[model samples]
Target: MVTYNTMIHGFCKKGDLYTARRVLDRMKDSKDCLPSTVTYTTLIDGYCKKGELEEAMKCMSEMNKQGCLPGLFTYNALIRGSFNKGDIKNAQKVFDEMTCKRDIITYNTMIHGFCNNGDNYAQKVFDEMTCKRDIITYNTMIHGFCKNGDNYAQKVFDEMTCNRNMITYNTMIHGLVKKGDLDTARRFGLNEG
Candidate 1:
């Protein structure tokens, strides 16, 4: 199973999805070793990265048909793939259909996707997060708000009392500069320095 997975990973890494699928088919034929969650995830991620969302969805369906429950990573890959393809509807559908408990990565992915697409739902996802958010979560929101040319970035920045990494400061400063608030940007840079 390890060997087969490695071969699949190699093929997928090389963008040889055709060979990757063939390897997966061969692995499925083996009685002792079946495709695991990792195997399907690798293939799905590869397809997603290649912008081959249809193939990724097909692989997801095959994984479900094989009785292998999709894990968090699997769902994340699908959501990201859908979003990357600018298929927000499908991305939301995948997110809504997720059965497993969502982790930070899932929420973060959605937030990033929504923000990148200039969608206002980034805040909705941020507000819906019940789990503890890390720096990435806050950073994503701040950056999104700034990108959208809203004052929400300042609101979010003011809310963060700690865990403010360089990214947080830089993003805030950049946003301020972009908004023609050079004074605020200079103050932030000085404080960071």
Candidate 2:
């Protein structure tokens, strides 16, 4: 059962949600095995990655009904599923329900979701997170700003003076170039390290 769960996880990680589902079905058919939380988690993750939020929620419900305890990963997957579907309300509900224990990756996933939407609300999420923000978090918002021509994104770049990564420099240069600010782009390109 453990190996089966791991196989499903591997398939999901490789973005082969279809194969993951097939493995899950095989697990379900096996009389000798009982699906664990790991099994449900793998299936939920696979569904989330494939943007099948309804199916992912079903997996969550079934996991509970089967008396399998959900861990952080299960909740994380559901949160991401909701976020991916642009259901921020549901995502917030899931987030609010999580106990005090938190992971940085959960916040990062939410940041990415909001950024991908090109909505200004992403910045609010960033502002509210007390967890240490990493390069990916900054980059996601920066890219979103550049994509949407939101000046607020530029303000974030100005605010990030501590961890100036190469991607950060490159994104700024790309943003400037997009706006026909060749001089600024050249200056930013020189800052790339």
Candidate 3:
């Protein structure tokens, strides 16, 4: 069964949805081997990566129908898929559901999902996350703001100065240079001195 899982994962990684489904179907046919949550997750993740939200959502629903309780990771994958599809309402729904069974990974995934989707209200998610925001959270938000070309991204960079990590500094410096604000970058560099 583990071999089947690996095969499913390999197919998923290669984005061979057809072959992945075939493997999944074969697993279902075996009385001794039922597809586990991990197997389903790998398939859903592949669908999400391919921007096939409909397929992913259908798989999630089927997982539920098969009496498989999704773990936080499964929910996170769905939330990410919804976010990637720009379906903020569905993403928020999954996020709210995850809050009832809070986990650090779940929070981080939702935050990164919103940040990656470039949703303005991603800041609300950042503010409301109960877990400690790791460096990745800050970097994700910074990248999102930079991609959005928001002037207030400077304010975010200013706020990040309190943290003063290398990646934070690098992001701000790059952002400033991109905006042709070498003076501000030089001032920040001096401040770090």
Candidate 4:
């Protein structure tokens, strides 16, 4: 059963949500094994990745109807989907719904959503996080700002409390290169060293 679910996830990753849904339908009817949260979340993620939020929400509904609770991973996928759809409001709703289970990833996804939306709202979310901010949070904000042509990514990078990694440096460097700011990128690398 887990193998079948894994197959579904693989199908979803390939953007073949149709086959994934078919596999899921079969999994739902299986008498030997009930569908697990991981199973539903995987489908949701696949649909979300494909920017099929309607289908993603349907999967969320089905997951709930089947008595499986959506985890932070599930919500993160949904939030990301909403962001892709340019629906930060929906992402916030999902974030708010996650009162207890909101983790660093949750906040990071929200921050990324806001950054992608070009709203600079990630700052508010970042400032309000109860969970310890991690490197992904910093990287996402930096990437988002850089991606959106916001000049404040440097501030975000400077303010990061979490340990920086290659991805973080690479994202900043990528941003600087994209902005034709090689000198700053080199300077950033120098400052880090």
Candidate 1 per-residue lDDT over residues 1-193, each given as its tens digit: 8898899989989999999999999888976799999999999999998999999999999999999999999999999999999999889999999999999899999999999999999899999997888899999999999888899998888787457899999999989999999998999999842
Q: What is the C-alpha lDDT of each candidate?
A: 0.92, 0.81, 0.77, 0.85
Give RMSD to native, each candidate: 1.9, 3.6, 3.2, 3.6
**Residue 36, candidate 2: alpha-carbon lDDT:** 88
lDDT of 4 by residue, 1-193 (tens): 7798889988988889999999888877876777888999999999888889989989999999999988878999999899898877888888888735678778878887787777777888988989998988888888988897778888888888988888888888889989999898897777552
lDDT for position 33 in model 2: 85
Model 3 per-residue lDDT at 33? 90
Q: Which ten residues in a row have the lowest lDDT in candidate 2?
A: 96-105
Assess the local accuracy of residue 2 in candidate 2 as a C-alpha lDDT between 0 and 100. Answer: 80
Top model by TM-score, which number? Answer: 1
- Screening candidate 4 with a backbone cut-off below 3 angstroms (N, C-alpha, C), the clashing residue pairs are none
**Each candidate's clash count:** 0, 0, 0, 0
User: In model 4, what lDDT does residue 151 have?
Assistant: 85
Candidate 3: TM-score?
A: 0.78
lDDT against true structure, model 2: 0.81
Query: Which sections of candidate 3 miss by over 4 Å?
Result: 99-105, 143-163, 174-182, 191-193
Q: Which stretches of candidate 1 lie over 4 Å from their true place?
A: none
Clashing pairs in 1: none
Model 4 regions more than 4 Å off: 142-158, 163-193
Q: Can you write out model 2's per-residue Cα lDDT over 22-111, one digit (the tens) per residue?
A: 887777788678788889988898898889898888888888898888888988888888987888877877777875455777878777
Number of clashing pairs, model 4? 0
